[model samples]
Target: MNKNIKHILIILALFASAYNASAKDYLITDFGAKADAKTDNTAAIQKAIDECSAKGGGKVVVPGGEFASRMISLKSNINLHLEAGAKISAIANGAKYTSLVMGNEVQNVSVTGSGTLFGNGGKFTIGEEAPNRPYIIFFKNCKNVLVEDVHLLQSASWTLRLFGSEHVIVRGVSIYSHANLNNDGIDIDGKDIIITGCHIDSGDDAICLKSEDSTKRVTENITITNCIAASNCNLIKMGTGSIGGFKNISISNCSLRRATESPFHKWADKPDHYIGIPISGISGIALEIVDGGVLDQVSITNITMTGVQTPIFMRLGSRKNPTGSFKNVIISNITATSHSRMSSMIAGVPGFNIENVTLRDILINSQGGGTREDAERKVPENEKDYPENRIFGWTIPASGLYVRHASNINIDNFQVRLAAPDARPALYLDDVKQLKATNVKVDGEYIIDKAVYKANAVNTSVNQ
Candidate 1:
C-alpha cells in the first residue's frame, strides 16, 4: 500500500475507536440516582446527562424502576433512553423547571424507549384560573430530534411539544393526558416534521399545530399520518395561535373520536363527570387562522371520525389583525358521524373570503333535529371572536354543511344524511362565488345564492 493511504487508514481506525468509547451507555443509578420513587433524582439524572454530554455523546440510561424528579434538561448528541418498565414520576411541586423534560437549542438529541413518563397531574389545580402547570416534554429550537416508542401519561399541561424545531420525527408514541385543562397531546410548531403512528388521548386538542406570535416561526412542510387521536376538544387542529402561519401541510389516514375520560369537563370541580359515557368531541378536524397569518396549501385525506360534535370546521377570523388568508385547502375521503345539531362550517369574515377550497368524496351522518325556525335564523358574523363550531349557535342554518364568505369552492361526490328529519337545508352557501358541485346528494334542501351557483357545470339532487 501507498504510505499516504496507510496513514489515512490508521487515522480512520482511531476515530472509530474514539466514537465507540464516547457512545457507551451511562446508567443513572450509577450516578447516585435512587429509584425507590421517594428520593428526588433530579441532580443525579442531570449529573449523568452532563457527564455523558461532556465526554462527547452517549445514551443516559434510566433503568427499570420508579424514579422521582422535578425536571431534567437534555443536551446535544445525547440520547435519554428509558428502559422498559422504567417509570419517571414528576415531583408534585416544583418552581425550577417549567417542563418535566426540556431541551433548548440542542441538536441530534433523542428520547427513545418503551418506558413511561408520568406527570403528577392530579396534584395540580384544575380550571383556567389555576396556576400554570409544567409541560411534560418540551424541546425548543432543536434540530434532528427523535422521540419514539414511549408512553407519556397524565400531563398537567401540554404533552410533547416541539417549538421552532426542524428535522424532527415523533413516531410510535402513546400519550394519555386527561388530568387537567389544556392538556394537549402533541403540539408541532416547526418545519420539516413527521409525526406518525402515535396514539393520543387527551382532555384538549389531541394533535395540534401552532405558530404562536412569540415564536414567529412558519410551520411548514409537516406531515402526519396513521395516528389515532381522541380528545374532548379537537382531534386535529391548526392555529388559533397563528402569527407566522402554516404552509404545505398534509395529514392522512387518521382516526378521530371522543376522549375516554372527561375528568374536568368544562372546568367543573367534579372529576369523571362524564363517567360511563364519554361526551362527544368538539370537532374532528379544525383549521383556524384567527391571528394575523396565512394558511395555505393544506391537504387532508382518508380520515374517519365518530362521536364528534362537528366533523369539520374552517374559520378565518380577526383575532389580532383585521384579516388573514386561508386558501388552497383540499380535504377528501372523509366519513364522519356528528352527534350535535351544529353543522360543519367553512366560514370567513364578511370582507375576507376563504378561497380555492375543495371537498371531495365526503359523507356525514348527522343527528339532525333542525327546525324551520333554525334554518331561517341568521348566522352571526363573529369575525373578531374566538373560532369554534358552536360560536355561531347550537343549531346552524344548515343541517349538514354550512359555508359562507368563501369563493371558488368545489364539492364533488358529496352526500349527507340524517338519522331523523331535519327542517333546515342540507347545504347552505352564502356570499360564495364560483361554486361547483358534482354528484351532490342531500336529504333536505340546498339553499345557495344564484350569484355563486353554476348551472350546467354543477349537478345537484335534493330530497325533502
Candidate 2:
C-alpha cells in the first residue's frame, strides 16, 4: 500500500470507529441492492436508507463492489459508509442526474470511507445539445455534517458543494477532475466550515467559497489548511457571485500548482478555447467582490505555488448589484514561480477603492519579457464587466505588481525576480493613497527608479 492511501485509511478507521460504535449498521446487499455495475440500484439504496432511518439513525453500509445509482438522498442521523474497494458510479439519463448524494436540512450526517465515487464527467458536453450536469455531493441547510476519506473522481460539475450549511468538517477527501467544464473541486457557501488534509486536481477552481443566498445570510468563519491543489483555473477563489458576502476567512499551509496532465490542456492554453469557448491561464489565488458582496478580515498565508500565470489576482466592482466594500486583507509568506504574461493585480472600481491591505514576506520569480508598450497600455475602467485577471487585457501595465484605486496599503519584505529582460517597471502604483513599502527588493537589489512606477499616488513612501 502507498503512504497516501495509508494515511487515508487511518482517517477512515477513526471515522468508522466513531460512527460504527453508535449506529446499527445495515449492509445494502443484504437489503437486495444489486451489486451489478449496470443495474440501477437507486430504489434499493433508498429502501435501505429508509430502513436504517426507521431504526433510529444507523449506517447504510456499502460493501466492496460496483453499484450504479442515479441519485441517493441521505437523511438526518444516518451515516452512509462505503467500505474499501467499494464504488458508486452515477448512471443518469435525459439531461443530468439531479445529484449523486444530497443532504438537505439534516443534522448528525456523515459520509466516510476509503471508497470511490465516479461521476463520468467526460460523457457530458457544453454545447447547446448537452444539459447542465449535476454535482457529485451537495448539502443545503445542513448542520453537524462530516465527509472524510473518500476518492471523488471525474465530477460533472462542481464536485462537492455545501450551501447554507453550518458546522461542517471535511477532511482527507481527494478529488481528481478534468473531464468537463466548470468542474470546481469544492464550493463552500456555508458558515463555520473546516476543510483540511485534502488533495484536489481539477480543470477549474479547486477550493472556492461564495455566498449566493437571497436571505442575506453571509458565508463566514471558513478555514482551509494543509491541502494541495492543482487546476487550470484559480486554485483558491471567492465571489464572482457574491450576493450575501464573505467574512472572517483564513487559508494557510496550502500549495497550488498547474495541472500538466489535464486531458483538456490544449483548451486551456493561452488564447485557447474550451470546445468553442475561450479560456485563460490559471491563477494561484483569485478573489473578487463584483456582485454586491462584503469581503473583509481575510488572511491567507504559507502558500507556495509554481507554474501559475498570476500569483494573486483581486478585484472589487459593481456589476448588476449594489457597490460593496472590500478591505482588511493580509497575505503573508507566499512564495511563487509564476508566468509573466500579466502582473499580480489588486484593483477596485472608480469610486470604490480597496482599503487596508497588507503583504508581508512575499517572493515571486516571474518569466518577465514585457515591453515598454505593454507598460504604457491604457487601463480601462472595466467596472461593470466580469471580474477576473485575464479579463483585464492580455497583459497588465506592470511586470510584477499592480495596485490601482486602493488605499492604506503596506508591503514588507517583498521581492520580485524576473527571468527575462523587460523594459517595464517591476511595480506600478496608480491612484493609490497612503502606501508604504519597506525592505522591498527587485532581482537581487533595491533600485526604485528601475523597479517602481507611480501615477496619481499620494502620500506614498518606499523606505530608504
Candidate 3:
C-alpha cells in the first residue's frame, strides 16, 4: 500500500473509535411518534432527540417505518440512527422552507443508518424557480461529524451541505437528487474531512468543496476516495465560491460520468435533436479561484471519466477579487473520453499566472471536429467572466488541451486520441513560460505562440 493511504486508514480507524463510546439508545416511538406516512412527526422526533441530549449523549433511534416531518434538528453528542426499512419524507409546505435535518454549532454528532431520506422536491417548485425549498441536511459550525450509510433521494436543494465545520466523515452514502435545480450532492467547506465509498447523481456539481464568504475558515485537509460521481454539472469542483480558499486536498480512485436524469434548469444544454437524452457533465474535474482565495496543494490521481464536456479545467479568474493565487497542482493516472467542442483548459489572468502545475500519465479520447478557422481563432482573456468550461465562447482552438497564462508547467507521457479528424492543434500554449514536455503524443499539431518563452520539448510527436 502507499504510505499516504496507509496513514489515512490509520487516522480513519482512530476516528471511528470515538463514536463507540456512546451506548445509550432512545427510541422515537416512545416519544409519541407515529409510523404512519401522513402523520407529522417533526415535533415527536425533535422531542426524542431533545430528551436524549438532555440525558447526555445517546442514539435517537428511528425504527422500520415511514415518518413524515418538517424539520429535524440534531444537537451535540447525539446520533440519529435509523434501522433498515426506515424512511423519513419531508412534507411539502409550499412557499415555506426549512431544512429536513440541520445541526448548528454542535459537536460529536452523527446520522447513520441503512435508511432513506426523501424530500418531495417536485412539489416545491413553480415554473423552473424554486422560490422556497428545503435542504435535506445542513450542518454549520459543527465538529466531529459523521454521516454514513444513508440513502438520500429527491432533495429539494443541496442534499448535504457542511459549512465551517471540521473533522467530518461521510461514507457509504447514496444520493440521487435530480428532482430540483441547484440540488448538489454534497457541498463541503471544512477541514480534516473524508468522503469515501459513496455514489452521487445530482442536478448540479457532485462532491464540491467551497469556502463561502460567510466564514473565515478555509476548506483544507480534505480527502475524497472510492466514490462514483455523476452530474449534469461538474463532477468534482473546488470553487465557484472561493472566499477563504482551499489547501491540502487529495482525490483518488474515483469515477465520473454524466447524470442519469434530464435537467430541470436551462443551464444544462439539451438540444432539439437530443431532447430526451442525458447530456454529459460540464467538466469532470474543475478547480477555480475566483473570489480572492489561495488554492494550493491539490493532488488528483487514478480518475476515470466518461462522456464529459471537458475532462479537466483549472481557472484563476478575477470575478469578485483579483488577488487570488493558484499553484502547486498535480494530476496523474487519468483516463477520459469526452464529446464536446470545448477542450480541457488551464487558464489564468494576465498579471496572475497559475504556477507549478504537473500532469503525468494522462490519456484522453475526444470527439474532435474542429475546423481550421477554429484553430486560427483568437482567444480572449475573460478575466472577470464566470468561471466555467465554455465561459470564453465555445469551440476552443485546441482539440486536446489549451494552456494560457501559466508558468512552470510540466507534462510527461500525455497522449490524445480523436474520434473525428480535426484541423486544429492538439495542444496550444499561449503566454506560457517554463513549459517542459516529455513523450507527448498528439493526434494533430502542437503549437506554442504569443509570448511563450523558454519552452523545452523532447520526443513530442504529431499525428503519432
Candidate 4:
C-alpha cells in the first residue's frame, strides 16, 4: 500500500495492456483444414491464408501435417507459422507449382516456423532428358521481411531467393538439396538484409550474393554470419550475374568445407564437360566489380575452410559495360587446409582497377603439387556464349596471391606452405601500385619475387 509501489504496479499494468493489444494469432487448422491421417490438404491450407489475410494480418498456422501445395503467396502483416513436425511439401509436377508466390512491395511480412518446406524437386524436368524442372521459392520486392526456423529440402534450383527486398532477416534456416541440380541455398539480390545461423548443403554455391543486371539497383548493407556451408560449388560467392552490383557487405564467423567427390558432374552430360571448371573446393571468395557496376566496401572475416581447392581467388575487370573498379575490400582471419593450389588474383580494364584491398592473417596448407591441370585449362570454345568468358580469362595462375592492374593493396600476416618445394611462389604481383607486404612468411622464408613485383613509373612504390 506504499505510494511508490502503487505507481510501479500501475506502469506494469499499462505495459501489459499495450502488449496484448498488439499481439494476434490465426490458426490454419481451425479453418476447415483437416489434418487427416491421409489426405492432400493443399487447398485447405490456401484457404487459411486467404481468410487470415482478409482478417487483417495475423499468423497463418500450419499444424503438424504433410500439406502438399504448389505455391502459397504471402500477404502484408501476415506471419506464416508452421508448428513443430509440420511439413508443406511442394508438388512434384511443374504444373502444380505453376503459380508463383508474388510479394510485390508488401511490408511487414514474415514466414517463421520450426517446420519444413520441401520442394519435391526430383519430379520436375529441365532439359530434353533432364529428370526434373528447377523450381524455386522466391520473394520479390518485399520490405521488413523475416524468414526463420524453417528447413527447405531437395529444391530443384536455387532453394531460397530474395530479389529487390529491404530490411529482410533470414536466420536459423537449414536447406538440404543434394539431389537437385544447381541447388544454390540462398541467392540474395536485395539490400539491408541479414542472413545468419543457417546451414546449407547444396549442389551449387551455398550462398550467392549476385549483382548482375545493370538495370536493377545495387544491393547494399548485407551481412551474413554464423553459418556452416558444405557440399557446394562455392561456400559464399558474389557477382556471377548479368546485372546489379553489390556493396557494403560483410561475411563472418562461417566454416566452409568443399566436398571431395565432384558434385558438378551430376548435372553435366559428359564427365569431361566440366573438368577444368574449378567446380570443386571453395574456389575463391570473389569480389569482381565487373560487367558494368561498382563494388565497394566489402569484407570477409573469420572464415575457416578444409578440403578446398583454391583458398583465395578474386577477379576485377570491365569487359561488357565499362562500369568497373572494385574498391575497399578487406579479407582477414581466413585459414584453409587443402591439397589443391591456392590462388588469388585482381585484374581489370585499363582505367578501372582493384583498389584499396587488404589481406591479413591468412594461413593456407596446400599439397606440394602444382595447380591442377584441369584447373589450369582454358574455358572451352563451346561455352563462349556466356558473358563471364568475355570478361575474364579462363585459367588463373597457381600462386598464393596474384595481383595485376590493382592499386593500394596491402598484404600482412600471411603464411602459406606448399606440400613440396617445387610449388609456386607464395605471392605474385604484376602491374600494381602502392603495394606493401609486411610480416608475410612463406615456406619458412620471406618471398621477395621481383619477377611479379613492379614499382609504378610515377611513384617510387610498386606500381604506384
Cα lDDT of all candidates, in order?
Answer: 0.83, 0.82, 0.83, 0.65
Per-candidate TM vs. native? 0.90, 0.91, 0.91, 0.81
lDDT of 3 at 169: 84
Which tens-of-lDDT digit does each residue in 1-464 have in candidate 1?
95324533453353334334536799999999998999999999999999998998778999999999988999987788899999999898645467889999988788889999998887777765567588899999987788989999998788889999987878899999998889999999998788889999999999999998465668998889999999988999998788889999999999999899887664223332211124868889999999988999999999999988889999999988758799999999999988777889999887798999999999998777666777778888977888878788777877777888888888887778777777776777777777777766665433333212212322332222
How large is the C-alpha RMSD of every model relative to the true structure? 6.8, 4.8, 3.8, 7.0
Scored by lDDT, model 2 comes in at 0.82
Please provide, for model 3 over 1-464, each residue's C-alpha lDDT reduced to its tens digit, 9 standing for 90 to 100: 97446645664564455445556688999988898998999999999999888887778899999999988999987889889999999999653656888899998888999998887777677334556788898888888888999999988888999988887889999999888888899999988888999999998899999999565468998999999999988999999899889999999999999888755644335442121224778899999999888999999999999968889999999998655999999999999987777888999988789999999999988777766777778888888888888887677877777888888888888887877777767677777877777766665333333211122332222222
Candidate with maximal TM-score: 2
Candidate scoring better on lDDT of 1 and 4: 1
Model 4, runs deviating above 4 Å? 1-25, 32-40, 96-102, 126-136, 212-214, 259-263, 266-279, 282-284, 371-398, 444-464
lDDT of 4: 0.65
**Candidate 4 TM-score, C-alpha based:** 0.81
**lDDT per residue (tens digit) for residues 321-394 in model 4:** 65555789999999976544335556654556678988889988755444345233342222123222112342
Q: In model 3, what is the error at residue 250, expressed in angstroms?
A: 0.6
Residue 319 miss distance in model 3 (angstroms): 0.6
